[model samples]
Structure formats: C-alpha cells, structure tokens
Target: MPDLVAIASPGRRRQIIIRSAASCSPLGGALARAGILVLPAPPPGRREGSPAGEGTTNMGLQPPQGSCRGGVPWGAWGTVCTALCCADGLVYALGGMGPDTAPQAQVRVYEPRQDCWLSLPSMPTPCYGASTFLHGNKIYVLGGRQGKLPVTAFEAFDLEARTWTRHPSLPSRRAFAGCAMAEGSVFSLGGLQQPGPHNFYSRPHFVNTVETFDLEHGSWTKLPRGLRMRDKRADFVVGALGGHIVAVGGLGNQPCPLGSAEGFSLARRRWEVLPTMPTARCSCSSLQAGPRLFVIGGVAQGPSQAVEALCLRDGV
Candidate 1:
C-alpha cells in the first residue's frame, strides 16, 4: 500500500529508474477499500526492462490513509515547495507556502527507514517554488516566488553539518527560472524578469539571461551577453546532460506554449538550438535518468498528459 514507488524504467541502461507516487487504485470498489493488501516485491535476479510486480513494502504497519496519505508532517505540508531525493536516499522538503498562503522557512526530511519525517533547521529565506540543486553536502536554493511577486533570496542547507547558510542573492529577480548543476557550478537560466525598484513602471517580461554560481569561487557570475539562451522562456524544464544544459518546452512570448528546445554547452560557452519537442507544453514535471530527460504532463490547450524525453549521447 505504499503510495510512493520507484521502478526501473524500460529500455534504458537499467541502472537508473524513475520514482513516482501512485495516484489510483487498481480495483475501484469495496475490495480497494479493504484497507489491507499485499504488494509483491521485485523478484531477485529479474531481467531489466521487465515489468515490476505490483509492490508495496511491508513496514508492518498499514499505509497511511485519507488526507494523511502522501501528506507531509504538520511542519512541511504546503503548495509550491520542492521535494528532492538526495544521494543519501533521504527526501528533503524545502521552502513552501503555509496554510495562510504565507511563505515558510521550515525544512524537513523524510526518513523511509523509520517511516517518519524529521524537522530540520529552517531556511533563512521563506519562499515557494525555489529552484534547488544538491552539490556535495550542500543543497542550494535559488530564487522563488513570494505570493505573486518573485524574490531574489538565495540560500543553502548543509546536509552533513545540519545547518543553513545564506548565499548571495540572485543578481536579479526572476520567477519560474530553471536551475541546473554543470561543471562544478549551479546554473540559473531564463525566466520572467519581474519589475523591481529599477523598473517599477515596467511590466514583467521574459528574459534569456543566464547566470552561474561557481562552487569553488563561491560567487555568482553572469554569463556573457552572447551566452544567453536563444529563446525567451519561463517555467521551462531544464537538466544537465552530456556536458550541456537542455531547456525544454515552456511559456514564451507567443500566445501558445513553446515547443522549441535548446542546449547550452559548458565547453562551448554558448547556446545551441536543439530538436523541438513533439508536443508543445509548459510547467511540465521533469525527471532525469542517466542521459535522458523526461518531460511529463503539463499544460497545452488545457491540462495535458503528454510525456516526452530528450536524450544526449556523444554530444549529439
């Protein structure tokens, strides 16, 4: 009865898999409501690309039900937050909105071994939808929205030290920006540059600017003007693959969502246009496994169920 499940994706290296939460009951009647069931475990020595048996871990306790199901503990439950699985197999939940729609500074971690969540030191900045990247023991959180407006607060949490660190804020205010790690740096890509003190009378607009936070230098560096993304977009799905940062479909200046895709090469130090997505979309959920970056359900004309992936091999 486990809600969250990780399974090996088919036809790939078989070493990497995608973890997703279960959303529906297979049997939709009284049998489904029994509140008790068994989930088979993956058979030992099973071949890759094979289907996984219906499975749930037997923690010796019934899976949580009702609103409590898939819900975070009291301190970390809210919308527009980021939940990321680190190399240590722990789920780290970062800044999000609280019940009153106010931003929260709280940080929490889910311990699957004990089937419980533990609170951690709160972040110095309170905001939701911040882009986060895990580098070594530090989790860097970048710009996120505060209510309808965007904030430039940048922060990080040290997993080993059990402490929080405030880094230099983003040089500019950007909402829906994409964050990725490449070549020992945290790269922040295009987004809607909102109006600020310098542009109070101007309306929010999309930008193609790119910036990077060097892990070694410990400072933010704006890429040269020529290195900016070719397309002006916000809320794009971005991931680092094959020594390049790939930006998938997202909202652009057009009335419809964008389908164009582009990649920024770390070695080349410039943006290059790539193959367009089969389906145009924005605000899509993304997952990276090995060389493939999966772009899942997102808005098109309406709510969409499209799923597509971009793969990189030998710098192709």
Candidate 2:
C-alpha cells in the first residue's frame, strides 16, 4: 500500500473521491465493499458568509491527492473514533484512541481551500469518545473518557481568538455520548460511565438521560424526558438540520450496532424517526454540510469507514 497525501493550495477547491479495489488491502477493500465515498475538503476562503472572517489556514504537510477519505486524510496514522466538527469552513479533529489503545491529545484542523491539515494546541486533557459541536465561532467539547474513566469537564475553543476556555462540568460524567447544538443551546444524551478500565466493555451500561446547556443563559436544564423514553441505546451522532436535532446509531445490547435514527423537532417538541442508514454503526461522527447530513467512520463489529449521506428534504 502506498502512503498517500493530498494538498490543496491556499485558495483552491478540490474534489476528493476514494476508490476501493477488491484486491486492495483489508481496510481499503472493506471500504470499497461498503460503498462509501469520502468527501473532499471544504472549499477555501472562510466558506463564504461565515460569521468568523477568513478563518485559520492549513499548516500540516500535504498528503497525496486521493489518498485520504474524500479529500481530507487522517493525520499521520488513521485516528479512528476521533471527534470532528466544522466551523467557518474549517474542520477540526480532536482526541481519539490510537491503535495502541492510548488516547491522543493532538488537535488538527483542515482548511478546505488549501486541502491541507494544520496542527493546533493540544487539548488540556486527552480524551476519546468525546462529543464536540460548533456554535458561533467556538467549538464546544463535552464529556468523554480517559482510558475508561468518564469525564464531565467541558471546554470550548475559539477559532478567531485561538484559545480554549473551560466551562462548567456536565451534570454527570459520560463517555461516547451524542451532542448537538441548536438554537444557541447544546444538547447531550446517552453515554456510559464504566466502573474501571478492565470493566469498560464487560457490561455496557447505557443511559437514557438528556440534558441541554443554554449558551445565552450559561445554565443547564434537564429535558422533559430522557432521550430513550424506554429504549436503552447509547447515541452516537447528534446534529442539527433545518431546525431539528437528530440522533443516530449506537449500542443497544445487541450483537450489532443499530441502523435506527431519530430526530427531535425543536419547533414541535417531539421525536420522529427518520430513514435508517444502509448500515449499522456506532461512535461515528456526523455533520451537516450544505443540505446534506454526512455520517462518517464508525464501529460495527469493528472500526468501519462507511460514510453515509442523507438528504433532509427526503425525510419529510
């Protein structure tokens, strides 16, 4: 297998597509068999009309074109289970456990125009299974695990300011939870609090809790009902689309991950089921980009690179 890298110039836009061959390596072959396509990096120039003016530029060594998923390559080694978010056309990748099971603290940002990755200051604490979202010009990171230890600490990164600020802790410690931002508030739901590192996967203790933080009020509130209502599933991806908050995929005590997807309508105060994904996965990252919902890189029986795209208009 060739080490591939793709670089985009400061103001250029590129389309990246991943092609998998049957004879390719296990990872590549599996991806191709799954019918997944990685998206190219975001277009350059601060994503036109972004609230944050001319955001930061890419700073890392450029990988070869077509080597990474879509146009963005996983930095250095493939960092699966990492948290990702996009603000002002810049994509930010946060901590995840490496192949060695040790948590990584490196933070990398991608500039779509340049099609390059840049290094940023590391998180104060290393975390995996962390939930992240972007609001205004800031990226908010919430509860995750440090080697099986659930965390309640919350932090925010200011893109324009280029700094991180610690926020009030979550009401309860959690890891592998789903988080999303809507109407200037952050909603977190469904995660696990393992007893110890050795006991992490022994019995998956899932929560059905739902909590929200009002950015403007700087306070937290318990929602009317827990996310599950009765289902005991951990949520993987939480995102906002057209005034609705969607939660997709997670463990449900079944042998396989779930293809179930549900959404909360902020306008209606009700939960509705959307179209199920083609495959079942958990611990994946999801983002809404230009009228499409992209769910990327999750775990089924094992880590998967299956990327599924859904159109919001098709739902209603």
Candidate 3:
C-alpha cells in the first residue's frame, strides 16, 4: 500500500490527505457511530463558482473511512461509457449514453466530501463512448462515436477559464478505447471503430494499436503494440497506485466481454494482467479515488450497474 500524505494549497490553506488504506482514527470511529457526516455549507458549492470557505455555521464532518468494497443492484439500468475527471477538489462526470437512446451531453459534478451531485452545462457534442483527461485545469474529451458513426473530433473544456474549445480531431474514429493522461500526453489504446450501432456481442474487432497525442506538440504518434486483444479499454482511471496505471475489464472481438484486467508500467513500456474482475464487462467506467480502483457501470450480456473494487494486493 502507498503511504498517506496530506497535500495543502498555500493560497487556500485547505488540505486533502489521502491514505493507501482508510484510517481508524478517532474521527473515523465517531463517524461510523453517527452513520452520516454533515458538513453544513451554503447548500454545497456549484461548479461555476469560487472556492467555498469554511464558515462557523458550516461544519464539516469526516466520515469513518474503510477499504473499498463492491456490490451491485441487479436490474439497474442506465449504463454508458462515461469519463470521470477530477480537478480543483471535485470530480466531474462527462458525456455518456444512457437509457434515453440518444447520446448525453450532460455533465455532472460530485463532491465526495459533501455527498452531493451538481449538474453543469452539457458538452457541445452529445456523445457516448468518449474518453476524458485533465491537463492542468482543462478537461479534454476525445474520440467516440457520434450520431451513427464513430467520430475523430476532439473538444476540451477549461475548468478555470470556463470555456470550451475545439481541438484537432483524432487520427481515426474509435470508441471503447483505453485512455490515460500521463507525462503531458493522452494515450489512447485499442477500441472498435464500427460505422453503425453494434451491440456488445457484435463481431467488430478490437485494434491493438496505441496512439498518443502530445499536449505541447499538438501531434499524435502511434506507439508500439503492448497487447494484442481488441475491445480492451485503456487507463480507465486517474492517479497511480502500486506505481501503475490500471486497465480493467473489457471484451475482445470474442462473443463476450473478458474478465481479464491489466496494468501498464509507464516506465517499462509493458503490460501485466492483474487479477480478473468478478464479472466480465465492456464500456464500463473505472475511477481511481485515493488508493482503490472502482469499476462502475458497463455492459455484460446487458447493461450493468455492478460496482467492484480492485485492490493493489490483487494486481501488478
């Protein structure tokens, strides 16, 4: 497990302490007894506002933390290949397709501390299967299918500047690709580039190619192959635990999604399969919050809201 460290911003005097494993501190015990933590503020902060302050009337409670856990409510609907972005102390969920049939442009922000969700302006392009990465305060949404065909267009949303700008299109149209932001570049991995609405079990093949776009150079370069399977999504997470970028469950061109999980060694330029997920899924979302990786909604034989946790002890 990685060591816990507290990062404090000099200007705001606010701090965030992350631990590899949840602590059993006094605060944690108190929170567990209460069953809920109440941090009173002005009805939670909005995405388009200044940093919230700690006021006397506003009390923040620290919940009893524990290692990650997983459980799924069977029959739950509304699953899509969504991107999760974390910036400025909040996590923002970007574009995805839901049960509505049409791609969603809606952006939702969640504040874990406040246990609340805030809806923000939708993306200019309503798209599903797109991937998102953060460069400083800006968030970039890359290739995914739009309308009827996979698109290569790219757009970025600046959190600090509060504006959206169009970037150059990807070299090719791809969806369900693995995406990771590292060393100032967004690395996109293999995905399907079908031209029509194909279900998960469709025979569309997965590409083994790896391509990366340099933020500074404004150019894309295809990297050497690391894995040969198709439909395997990349990165699918943020932050590094166990000194690796974890890629979770995805399907190949095979009839069903694969339970296999893998991690990329950025320094080594190699891939290592981790412990397989309890379930096989594709088009799912994986989030790295603190030390655990949460594998959220995705499609198996059908859409699933099944949530699972991947721990370091179980992987490379």
Best by TM-score: 1
Tens-digit lDDT track for model 3 on 129-236? 676666766888887656556767688888766678877777756665666676777777777655444465654556656677888988888765544332354323
lDDT of each: 0.67, 0.62, 0.54
Looking at model 1, report the run of 10 residues with the lowest lDDT sum: 10-19
> Could you tell which candidate, 1 or 3, scores higher by TM-score?
1
In candidate 1, what are the lDDT values of residues 41-139, reduced to their tens digit? 233332222344423233222222221223233333333344343435566667777667898777766544443456678788888777776777778
What is the TM-score of candidate 2?
Answer: 0.66
* Full candidate order by lDDT, most accurate first: 1, 2, 3
Instruction: Give per-residue CA lDDT, model 2, range 26-110, as digits (tens).
Output: 3333333433322333323222222323432653433443242323343433454566665544557777776678877777886
Model 3: per-residue Cα lDDT at residue 283: 53
lDDT for 219 in candidate 1 is: 90
Candidate 2 displacement at residue 131 in angstroms:
2.0
**Candidate 3: minimum summed lDDT over ten consecutive residues — where?**
68-77
Clashing residue pairs, backbone N/CA/C < 3 A, model 2 = 5-63, 5-64, 6-63, 6-64, 6-65, 8-114, 38-70, 39-70, 44-113
Stretches off by above 4 angstroms in model 2 are 1-80, 98-100, 111-118, 195-204, 226-230, 296-307, 313-316
